[model samples]
Target chain A: MKISARNKLDGEIEAVDLGAVMASIKIKVEDPGVLTALITKESAEGLGLKKGDKVSAIIKSTEIIVGKE
Target chain B: MKISARNKLDGEIEAVDLGAVMASIKIKVEDPGVLTALITKESAEGLGLKKGDKVSAIIKSTEIIVGKE
Candidate 1:
């Protein structure tokens, strides 16, 4: 997955796998209602991400929190 | 604030305030570490956002979780 960067706040990126190393890199932000992540454990060990390794998911935009679920 | 939409998962938007009444519009998702928002509630009453109203904050990228402070 790739996106390098975006606007309004922050959305930078870098991702590589298949033994390419450089496995984790991400940043996306928008905090109004609540939505924040600042990950960096060597990119979770270059994407080795233990405990589970099924990545990719995103949310931003004033931390969307609509009412009356 | 506006962004419309983005990819890699989901990032949609539509924010307008200034008595224009069209305030809420957001969608950001990245559920690996936990950063998911789907706000609506008429855009939190068109940005009037009671209970406090100071917008803008963002965090995505596998829900960013790093250890070893």
Candidate 2:
């Protein structure tokens, strides 16, 4: 599936190993304990998203929540 | 953080219990093996996203990957 044009959130992105070809992306917010991410089985064959590699998290607005403290 | 506009993808949405107040949103695609999701530590108190809740999976272009079989 091809995804284009979506909301972007500025946060620290980190990749975590999920065994085999699956991996998880971690988005660290500045609010201390808030964390978000997009998990996929899409392997990082050539994308070069390593454990410590930095990347931008692209989020769709519909996937986000507001007014939560 | 407030998000208003973004791209959305149609998929089967399900909420999984992640212990405590944290929960995981599962996006089931038609491809069967390809599962994707946006994990948020944000609780589902008033959002009403239950285990069988039906919702759409919003995705951002930058978070998508192409060319893999």
Candidate 3:
């Protein structure tokens, strides 16, 4: 899919926790970190996401506040 | 700052484009991908964010739809 957002991290599925209305997906990207995504239960099932699957964390937000200290 | 979101990509500021009310911040992660963040101009200035500065791309969404094929 063509997305305007430029960040695309290559990672593997680490965990999948599905709730009634929401689901949390943990993607283990390189650099020794994990990217967690929260989505709807329906969407999670639709994607057939599971542990050891490869997926991209598609993040498109207009409120990505930048910080410096 | 304490956020519920678990995805925090550590990166360095690659670019900062400021407009009247909004600003676009680009961050280069270690995995050879760039993360783009769109925030308010006020927030951008308030954080004193600029190129070469290190910041985390904080993504917290309740609708991070996952896709697989």
Candidate 4:
């Protein structure tokens, strides 16, 4: 299925750390190294996310912050 | 300020499209092709963003989604 989010990074799961409410996922991508994603524990479990699984990190343009330094 | 967001892509502003309520910013990064950011029109005006300006795209892990196909 097609998604609206512009940033779709394909990578393999490096690790998964589940917390009480949230779950942290580490994805290893070739272009940008490691990308971290945090989602609800329920959502994580629903997707059956695990280490070494191939997945894509999807981010919308609105969620991204433009920082000037 | 040190942000907890792990994905920070430093890039130059390529374009800016301002709407009545929101604004779309296009940033060109070296590693990735281009990153798009959507922010409120007020925030865009407050930041005085313009083309050729150097900036970083900041995104929190929670705002990202993981998809498998």
What RMSD, rounded to one decimal, does every model reach? 11.9, 10.0, 1.8, 2.1
Question: Residue B25 error for model 1, in Å?
Answer: 3.2
Error of 1 at B22 (Å): 12
> What level of docking quality does candidate 4 show?
medium
The digit string of per-residue lDDT tens for model 1 on A1-69 reads: 333222233333333222343334333333322222345546656555443223333434444343321
* Clash count (model 1, backbone only): 22
Model 2: which docking level applies? incorrect
Q: Write the per-residue lDDT of candidate 4 for residues A1-69, one digit (tens) a residue.
A: 677787766789999999999999998876567889999999889999999999988889989999997
Per-residue alpha-carbon lDDT of candidate 2 for residues A15-37, written as tens digits (9 for 90 to 100): 46553324556666556533545
Error (Å) of candidate 1 at residue A17 is: 22
Considering the two chains of model 3, state its CAPRI-style docking category: medium
lDDT tens per residue, model 1, B1-69: 434322233333333332343343333323322222335556556545443223332344443342211
For all candidates, state DockQ relative to the true structure: 0.18, 0.05, 0.62, 0.65
TM-score of chain B of each: 0.21, 0.55, 0.87, 0.87
Of the pair 1 and 4, which is ahead by lDDT?
A: 4
TM-scores of all predicted structures: 0.25, 0.38, 0.88, 0.83
Instruction: Please identify which of the two predictions, 3 or 4, would achieve the higher TM-score against the true structure.
Output: 3
**Relative to the true structure, how large is the alpha-carbon lDDT of every model?**
0.36, 0.53, 0.77, 0.87
TM-score of 4: 0.83
Q: What interface Cα RMSD is found for model 4? A: 1.9
For residues A1-69, what per-residue lDDT tens digits would candidate 3 score against the true structure?
676754567788899998889888888889938877788878878888899998877667573545455
Candidate 2, residues B1-69, lDDT tens digits: the string is: 545536655566554544333345666655653344535446444566666565666655655544333
Query: Which lDDT tens digits does candidate 4 get at residues B1-69?
Result: 686787877789999999999999999876557879999989888999999999988889889899987
lDDT of 3 by residue, B1-69 (tens): 676765677889999999999888998878847878999888889888899999988777553545455
